[model samples]
Target: MNFKKIIVSAVAIAAFAGFTGAASAAIREVNEWGASAQFLYWSAQAPNYLQNIGCYNGGWTKTGPTSKYQVSVGTCANGDTFIFRVGEKSSFDGPLSVMGSTTDPNRGSIDPQEGCGDANPRQRLMTDETTCSGASCTARKCVDITVGASDVEGESFTQVSHGMKYGPSTATNNVWIDRAFSAIDTSSLANTRKLVVPFGEFVNNTVTKNGVTIDNLTRHQVVQIYSGQAWYWQDFGGDYTSLPITRCFRHAGSGTHATLDKTVMHSPWGGALLTDESLVDPLTWFNDSSSDLMKCINTIDGAIGYADADQIQKVGAGQTYPNVSAVKYNGVMPTRATIANGEYDNHWAVQNCYYRPTDAEAAAVCNAVKNVPSSKAGFWATTCEMTYMKDKDWTYPVYVGATCEAGPSCSDGLDNDFDGSADAADTDCQ
Candidate 1:
């Protein structure tokens, strides 16, 4: 059947009053059995209340024999016009009665007399019928259901607009952190006198230390030395070891690199030495290559490198080669506790930051991140942390469950877990 548009309009008066007229007056049939329902009306006076009851509402409670089905009414009204259509389904075998009303019945018409010429337009109300019979009797039950006008076009327009406004974008960068240290032996490095590597000045010689801790001094010193500013280890208060200090760093384009650059090379030092100019190409500094930072640390006796805390633990576990030693920065060891409490402060150089693809995508990703399992998201993922560092009032960096306060001396470099040698050398406690 061709689609028809239904419009209902009404006139308004200055005086506000309840409808004072016959409750039911206009009755019009717009269709027949096994057909659709359509109706329209326009009036000088509008109805105070309009009710459109479907066959499901106990169609036609007339005093007559129960039939298989019945017809119902459809309404379309604005301020003045009130139009209605009543129809019966093929399953319906009973008499149908249609009713309509307006606040001023005398002024409104349900089925316009001028619109539906001489023959009243029969409204075909849709109905679904199913037959059921018990030992006592057989009967057919009629269910009144109508297919109304389509508002899909309008709804589609709204949906498209909303999607365009909040759709995901392709501009954001994504980085993955590997858990290399989980397999390593971190406890063995406890209390060992291994060389410490500092990321920046924030990790100075004055910081506290625990066995196997990547102290603040070590982290800061590494940046200084790598950038060619601190030519010797003694420049930073460490023992003036004659051996050339080895430097380890995260690969280029890594979030770890970003954190290191921001906290150590950039912010604390005002980007004086390790500026973008010196480290012109991040890929040259760090990347997925084994011959890269990780390989350099593993092969070189005095080399150091920065990776995810998980990766550090993995190296200790013997899952991969014992790559590098955990350096002490400013004397304070980089234990999980120091990171959590902001005491060691060196760990603060790193962050697991997340951004939404778009404003709408943000809501969805944020929700998914919250629901994702920690095991699946990896060690450094922000599942445990609630505050986003970029957000307002966010005071602390997110902490993984790494801690050195379990009675392990931070300076010994011995694997307190009893798996192997000092610091980065331990295959279990990285």
Candidate 2:
């Protein structure tokens, strides 16, 4: 929540470097870059966490935005600012699933060797630093941020989606989350929901035409639409609109995209998805962050995508996404109650936090991120506040910390009386 801008004049590198060597050469400040700005912000602005991370200002400044990654900076007592967080790339998680190209390929579009031969070959990473060299970079500009600007290191964002979900947030999908690495498994903050651009384009799948009902997409319908099986507005049930469906997806390496891949397109480990965008050859659009995707969704008709439930709906009516109608998935809405109860699972994921320096400090930061107040964090359910847990992304919900009864007082294997038995065996559930 601390987006207080810190105005720093850029200083010459030589002088600052000399001062750094004499004053703070041994310090290597915390730098994190990964998914979800909201998730990362929880840690960067955590009460009393700045000092623990070698930061002293206890304040934060958000870089505009990124195609893949963005930074939220923090300051230390010595006037030095560090890259507190950046969105993760999942280290090329999941399969790259690109098809062979012809005269109209994206790889050659950039530099023939740079961009992804599949999407945009010139794709880049989401990490940026101060405008100049680190020693005195702050002097020239305390914090220089360029959102959506091409960091020579980033891959191209211009790519057509094939309804193929990018990467899931799981360690298995995002291997960096494996035990070998120091990571925190912060459970989901909120579920994700369906989004259509050109505001109010959906207007409810049942705009009511000729006494016929056009319903919002079901899990099956979602897959059908994304894979090109259902190509038009009439494909679902009614002749609501003549517009052909344009599948919108997060650029590769997006956790939300991965969640849709697992929970909806391929539910219950149901089946394989169409990997080749060419097979569907459906019209597609891609975005970097929640805001970017929302912007894309609102401006383009027949465009449908997904983002965090909170991020997608937190908008004030008519303030943003003014025309978009609420579309449902399988007749159930993605409410906190529904997501917590397992009715809507497509948009939620464990908010895992990873750190490189060491595990102890990593645990502390991760704990703070997981513990951010739901009110302050916006739409995210606290890790243990939910009533159920799932074995997989969209699997059956299992009652966790059930004390023979569902009550407010007991949870997550809590044992008030020192009894070894906590869940179902406890008197509450009994």
Candidate 3:
């Protein structure tokens, strides 16, 4: 049989087998909250098919829909079987027990918010309704709590959460966050500092520096830069001896910086450097500019810096300096696979968060903030004060590599495809 036919037949066989199980008295009720509320109902007749039948709080719209109520069919199924494509807070409601047969998948109904359903105090403001004038703002419509920088440690990363708590504040215009990497030439500086490069560039640089196989390094080293222990090149079994370590970090208020801190330093140093004042808190070992962080790593001996992989590539290609080296963590080198998998745990986290201001003005201001076009743009806008660092990189570990076949993907970075592969090559490798 042809590939298409074979695939279809396999699907049919699986479907048939799935339905052959004894009729279940359970009905799966999946509810999604944030930006919109979506519910899916499943019974035996539709054991494999979930019908999108109800909605509330927000409805579908042309420009962008928001309402106190809405419902759509065929949007989700089996409760936790879909990802929130839009960046919004959400939760699954139920897997209530019901009598269901393959001929009739509908069994029973349950409240969408019955269990620990998803709910965010923050709601995103409609784009057209917000405006920012100076630091103050106003929102045209009602909204959640206004999101402000909290004095609490780690609050700099809580913009969306706070915005939802105090939104609809005001309509205000602010800077847009952009994602781009800056170049640094260590040769130009009198003192060379160690820079921490992202996992990808670190791996390539490590290969170039030691002539070792990149794959030999454990995935952990590629993503995270451990403090102190992995400081010297010799630590990784490399030949370089007198490498002066220079710490590289994103701009003071960049989300990338926040993510790195959260992943690498949140445990031992939880509130130490992650306060509202120092948004992008590096390890406190080295100081370098976000633009030249990578270049510093490339040109300086014993240099280390952290940067987005894409930005590192750009700097390595365009700059006049020599390429930098990345250190390996636990023997695994950083690569697309390691990053996709949690094996290379680093500072980055899943980028998903939302907020709405209760104050009309704040809501309006929150709405005006748009997603950054690139890492470079995000970095620049945060530096320019057009946007706050909090909203730029709000991420959760949910939906890391989840697929429709299983429950919603959680942030642990597993292969939900059940294809025997864990992350990179899995069918659910998004």
Report backbone clashes per prediction.
112, 44, 107
Q: List lDDT for all candidates, in order.
A: 0.27, 0.40, 0.29
What is the model-wide C-alpha lDDT for candidate 3?
Answer: 0.29
Tens-place lDDT digits, model 3, residues 41-136: 101111121211111113221111322222222322222221111112221000111111112121111122211212321222222222423332
- Give per-model TM-scores: 0.34, 0.55, 0.34
What is the per-residue lDDT of model 1 for residues 3-45, given as tens digits with 9 covering 90 to 100? 1111111221111122223244333222212111001110100
Candidate 1 TM-score over all chains jointly: 0.34
Better of 1 and 3 by lDDT: 3
Please give the distance, in angstroms, between residue 202's alpha carbon in candidate 3 and its true position after superposition.
3.4
**lDDT tens digits by residue: candidate 2, 233-339:** 66765646666666555554455655555456653345334333332345555544455566555565666667666544544365566634456677765655565
Model 2: per-residue Cα lDDT at residue 238 = 60
* Model 2: lDDT of residue 69: 35
